[model samples]
Target: MIFQLGCSHGLPGIFACLEGAAAIHFQDFNAEVLQCLTIPNVNSNVPSFQRPALQVTKCDAGMEIHFFAGDWREIHKLLPYAQNIDVSTGKGLDAQYDIILMAETVYSISAVAHLYELIKMCITPSHGVVYMAAKKHYFGVSGGTRRFLSIVEKDGVLASSMVAEVGDGSSNVREDQTLSLFFLFLFFNLLPCGCGHQFGHLPLIWRIKYCNRN
Candidate 1:
C-alpha cells in the first residue's frame, strides 16, 4: 500500500506498484496533470488503472492503482480508507497505507501542515512510513526538507531519520526520510464521517494487503 502526493510524473509511485505495493494512489493538485502526464505514464507502465472497484485475474493477484486530483487539504474525501480512521487516536478502521511517497511536495511552506495532517490521517498506525524527496529548499519558496522536519520535531509525535542526502552543491536533502510510527492498529472499528477528514486508514505494520487473491 502506498500513496504518492503531489505526484508530478508519478515515477516514484509507479515504481512502488512495481515494487509490490498492492495499492498505489496518486494525488495531484491539477486534474489535468493526472489526466495528461500521470495517467498516461501509468498506463504505459502498468497496462491499466483502477479505481476503488476490485478486479483481479485468476492468474494474477493484481494491484489497485488509483489516481486523484485536487488540493491536498480537500482530496481526502474522495480517497478510500480515509473515512475509516479515528483522527483523535491516530488509528485506522479499514487499513492505512504501508508507505507514502512524495517528491517536491514540501516545496510549499504553506501546504506543509496540511500535507503532514493528511499523512497522519492516511498512514498506517505502527509500522507505516513515509519517503519524501525534495531539494534542501526551494529557491523562491522557503519550503524544504529542513523546514518540514521542524514541524515534525515540534509535534514530537513521530521520530525521523535521514535516509540519504544528495550534495549536488545544493544545500538540500537529496535522498529521502522516513517518519517513525508511534501508534497501534485500529482496523476493526470504523466510523464513516462523510465530508470530513477522510484520510485512508491502514495500520500496515508494514502489512501488505493486496486487492487480489493469493
Candidate 2:
C-alpha cells in the first residue's frame, strides 16, 4: 500500500501510485479539502484510469492514508501500523509510509523544520524514498529554494535527479502574477539519521514513500 500525506487536489504522484494498484490513503488537515477531493472522482481530467478508492477525514485512521487536522504533534499521537515508533512534542508524523508526499507546504523556515522531522519519523531501516517540490521563486522572492536545498544537504540526504520543471512567467493581474518556478527533489535513504532539522523554502509538490526492506 502507498500513502500520501497532505494530499491536496490529488496530484499525479498519488494517482500514479494508485495506477500501480496500490491501496491509497489520502490525507489533509482540512475536512473540507478532503471532501472536495471526492469531486475529481466524479469529474476527473484523466478519463482513462479509474480513480482509486480514497478515504478522507480530519483524524488519523489505521488506513494507509492518515490525515491529521491539527499540528503534526497531535497527529503523531494516533499514528499506527508502523513499528519502532517514537513520540515527541513538536515532532512530525510517526508512522512509516510507502511513498509519502508533500506539495507547496514549505514556504517558511519553521515549516521546513517540521517537514524534515516528519520525514525522519516516517523512515525505517528499510530503504525509503521521499519526493519534494518547491517553487524556484515567489513574487520576486528568492532564497526559499536555496534554503531548502541547504537544509537537506546538511542533513546528508541524497537527492535524485530533478523530476519536474516549470517555466517562468508573470500575469497581468497582481493576484495572478507568477512568482516562482517549481522544482522537484527526491531523497533515497541510504543510512539512518536519528536527528532532523527544518529550514525555509517556497511551496512545491512533495511526496514520501515507505517500503519493506526485504
Candidate 3:
C-alpha cells in the first residue's frame, strides 16, 4: 500500500499504480482537486482501456486506488489504510501504508506539525518508509526538510537519512557531503555548462523509517 499526501495531481500515486502497488491512496486539501485533476490523471496514466468519468474501486491491473480530501489533521479518518486504534484492545488496525511519498510538502511552517502527525498515523508500524523531497530552506516561508527533521528528532519515533542533496553553487557544501558522485555527474550532464544556479531552492531528498516506535 502507498499513500500520497497533499497530492495535487497525484503523480507519485499514479506512478505507484504503474509499478503495480497493491493500493494507492491520494489525499489533497480540496475535493475539487481530487475530482477534477487527480482522478483523471490516474485514469490517463494507469493503463485503463476505457477511462471512466467517475472514480472506480479497482483498475484493470487489480490495483486499488482511493482519494481523500481534507485537512491533514482530519484526513486520516477518511483513508482506508489509516492506523486506527482499537479502543478495547489498545492495538492499531494494522492497515497502514507501506510507503509514503511527498514532494515539496513542508513548505509552510504552520502546516508542518499537522503533516507530521498525519504521517505517523498512516505509515505502517516498525517498517514503513517515507521518501520526501523538499528544500533545505524556504526563502520567504519557514518550513523545510531541516525543520521537519527537527520535529521528527524531538518526537524520537522515526530516524531520517539524507538520500540526496541538490546544490546550485549558491549553498555551502558541508564536510559530510551526502550528495553522491553519480548524482553530481548526472546533474552536470543535464546542465552541461554547470548552470544549475538558475533554479532557486536547494532541494534535498530524504528517507525516513520507523525507529521502534509504535
lDDT of 2 by residue, 1-214 (tens): 4445566554533344334423455556676665556224323432343323333322122223333443543444445533244554222234445555555555565556656665666643265565555554444433344455566667654343344444335421111011112112211111121122121232333333322222
Which lDDT tens digits does candidate 1 get at residues 29-143? 9887777666666655654453322222111447767777888778777778776667674435554777777766777899998887777777776667776655567778888
lDDT (Cα atoms) of all candidates against the true structure: 0.60, 0.42, 0.67
Ranking by lDDT: 3, 1, 2
After superposing candidate 2 on the true structure, give the runs of residues whose Cα lies further than 4 Å from its correct spot: 38-68, 81-95, 139-143, 157-161, 169-214
- The number of the candidate with the highest TM-score is 3
Better of 1 and 2 by TM-score: 1
* Cα-lDDT of candidate 2: 0.42
Better of 1 and 3 by lDDT: 3
Better of 1 and 3 by TM-score: 3
Each candidate's root-mean-square deviation in Å? Answer: 11.9, 11.3, 6.4
Kindly give the stretch of ten consecutive residues in candidate 2 with the minimal lDDT sum: 171-180
Descending-TM-score candidate ranking: 3, 1, 2
> By lDDT, who's the top model here?
3
